[model samples]
Target: MRTPFFLILDAIIFIDVSGCQWRLLPKEYPK
Candidate 1:
């Protein structure tokens, strides 16, 4: 399934702020 830009941005921000690895981001469909 396709993913949303906002979701990707949020994931990046969250990872940056929380210092979480990119691979640790949620796997759920963005849209």
Candidate 2:
């Protein structure tokens, strides 16, 4: 159903934002 599809999309967006935030930090900074 549409609800399930939207839930999956929301999860993917959350993951993408976390990854982008990590990548955006200065490379010299340790993880």
Candidate 3:
């Protein structure tokens, strides 16, 4: 499925703020 750029960006921001690993991101989020 083609994911939205903003959603990916938001996910990145959320991860950065939360200090979560990239691999920890859910499959639904950006790769």
Each candidate: RMSD: 9.7, 5.6, 9.3
Scored by lDDT, model 2 comes in at: 0.83
* lDDT winner: 2
TM-score of 1: 0.49
The lDDT of model 3 is: 0.70
Residue 30's lDDT in candidate 3: 48
Candidate lDDT (C-alpha), each? 0.66, 0.83, 0.70
Clashing pairs in 3: none
Ranking by lDDT: 2, 3, 1
User: Best by TM-score, which number?
Assistant: 2
Question: What is the RMSD, in Å, between candidate 1 and the native fold over all Cα?
Answer: 9.7
Q: Which regions in candidate 2 have their CA more than 4 angstroms from the true location?
A: 26-31
Model 3: runs farther than 4 Å from truth?
1-3, 20-31
Q: Mark the regions of model 1 whose C-alpha exceeds 4 Å error after superposition.
A: 1-3, 20-31
Candidate 3 weakest ten by summed lDDT: 22-31
lDDT of 1 by residue, 1-31 (tens): 5469888998889878565444356554243
Q: How many backbone clashes does candidate 3 have?
A: 0
